[model samples]
Target: MRGEEMNFEPMMKMMSLSSIGLMIWIAAQTFTPPKEVVVYVEVPAPVVVTQVIHAPISTARPAPRPDSLCLALNIYHEARGEPLKGQVAVGQVTLNRAAVAYKGASSVCDTVFARKQFSWTHEDPRQPSGAELRPSLDLARKILAGRYIDRTHGALHYYNPHKVDAWWADSYAEVAVLGNHRFMR
Candidate 1:
């Protein structure tokens, strides 16, 4: 009976230890993070693969002439919201300035970008985008091509008449009052 009791006790202890070890393993598995696994499959012979590539096409318009571009930018920035005649008048002023040797500028671009000439050019020193400036560009092209009549009467300067106290306004002869701006000689 003693021998049997001893054997039974040892068997019980071993069973308890195994059960505790199993519980600990289960707890460890619960706390562990899952890992990503990738699987690969093999295809049988006689399989075909195909791929097609398409090239991109350009829809950009040709760049305008340098003088015309400068004129267009000036008109667009100066009087884009003004009437057609007003825009042409602004272009005429730019061309008139270019013709003269203002600040030693022999080209329209130099005249438009001359120091203290157009306030818009000074504000943002970047070229105007082509999409938003279609009307101004067209008018500038026409003016450069000499296709439109000069509405400013050969006026070389202009300013918004609504503003107060311009020093240069009194110096030059007021040529024409078209739209919000006053063309000056």
Candidate 2:
């Protein structure tokens, strides 16, 4: 007995390590690296913005999306002769009015045709061609989709520089001048 190593703590520690090591070895032997497993992950479809812009716009407007028709009409009628940015600016103003229910208008159509707010609203309804409405329609969809940058910086009003200097123009802060129209907050 004296010839053998008699350190009790070291012997106990060795025994514990052997037991744990034996259990680990058994577990390691039982584990078969899982068979070639197959995993599937779902991916969403990509949105093509250009496809939406180039799509045909119909005057036979859908009921649920009348906002598009109303917004397009505003842009086409208000800034058809002006540049593209001017047209978008006009649409932005109409959107701003609709957002706050201005003049008790709860929708884009209501805002566009609000009393004498826009000159064309008081006049005869004009039928614009799809080609004429293409740009406006594209811009309108973009605006409603929350994708368009507010070129007017939240302007709710605008008037042509060459046209009448409205008596109330001095009442609000002017925001931007896109083309012919001066935008105001």
Candidate 3:
């Protein structure tokens, strides 16, 4: 009870209390679960989403493999047993337009010929007129090369002199071998 007296019992009790607290802490740590846990997972069914990307599509199809529009036309006409002279004349018209020192533009008119132009009227007898007068070099080249003869109705066809017929002409007489003046070797 004195101020200067040593408190042994109190000190002993405090030490005991601390030792009990330490024992409890150690026991809790010893019984603790592992640091990492394991789990099982399953994947669900695959999901497919269709996305459309914008790209240019050519409504026009591939044409024949002739080098000159005239030749292809001739081949087509000759194949059908039609007149070769007219086909060649058509080809010549194309070349003439191509060589026009006066027109100052390429004779090739297949690209810009409107639907209502002179060439669009198939039964008009003047199918080979105006811009359509020129033969398509692209058409000729296809005939010459002996490639696919598209002859499709729409944008693909040998431009008739004035007619816009979609019917395909044969390439027998018109399609001649290169430099041989003949369709086949």
Candidate 4:
């Protein structure tokens, strides 16, 4: 009977210890924080595109008229020796004179060829070679095309400063002095 009692006591202690351990494990599972779930979403990257448009190129220049030719000749004879700015000023003056309708002259050609207007026109003016007059010709084309700005500030007359003073210089107001010439309005 003593052996039986001792064996029963040890069995009861083992069962109690196992039951305590089981209760602790269950408490830990109930009290512990839950693990967080992470979700990932993929986004598409933005695409960039570039485009260039080309314009059609013109191969030939338009045919020049008699008035344009006359204006070119006048610029060639008048301001060819001067700087490009001076040539442009001369062209502007011619255009300005044409605008004024001076001495029954209505067009650019008429204004340029008007009696005693340009010194070169007093005589039969010789046509300059294309190679010699290329700069004046180009400038004239730009002026006729209305692509040039007036540098003379609305000047209608210009004269070489080295030359003798003319009676007309006193009548019109002096506007500008460009290169070797003085512009008057």
lDDT to native, each model: 0.70, 0.73, 0.34, 0.71
Clashing pairs in 1: none
Q: What C-alpha lDDT, on a 0 to 100 scale, does residue 105 get in candidate 3?
A: 36
Write one digit per residue (lDDT tens) for candidate 2, span 1-185. Answer: 21222223333333444563464345335433333211111222342321111112223335537899889888888888988788878888998999999999989999998999999988897788878777888888887888868889999999996978688999989989899999898
The positional error of residue 148 in candidate 4, measured at the CA in angstroms, is 1.9
lDDT of 1 at 10: 35
Higher lDDT: candidate 1 or 3?
Answer: 1
Off by over 4 Å in 3: 1-82, 101-104, 110-117, 121-139, 142-185
By lDDT, the best candidate is: 2
TM-score to native of every candidate shown: 0.63, 0.62, 0.23, 0.63
lDDT of 4 by residue, 36-122 (tens): 211111122232332222212222344667777888889988888888788888988999989888788879999999999999998
Ranking by lDDT: 2, 4, 1, 3
Determine which window of 10 residues in candidate 3 has minimal summed lDDT: 36-45
Residues 123-181, candidate 3: write the lDDT tens digits.
34333332443343444564344354322211212343233343434531343322212
Q: State how far residue 96 of model 2 sits from its true place (Å).
A: 0.6
Q: Roughly what TM-score does model 4 have, to 2 decimal places?
A: 0.63
Off by over 4 Å in 4: 1-63
What lDDT is obtained when candidate 1 is compared to the true structure? Answer: 0.70
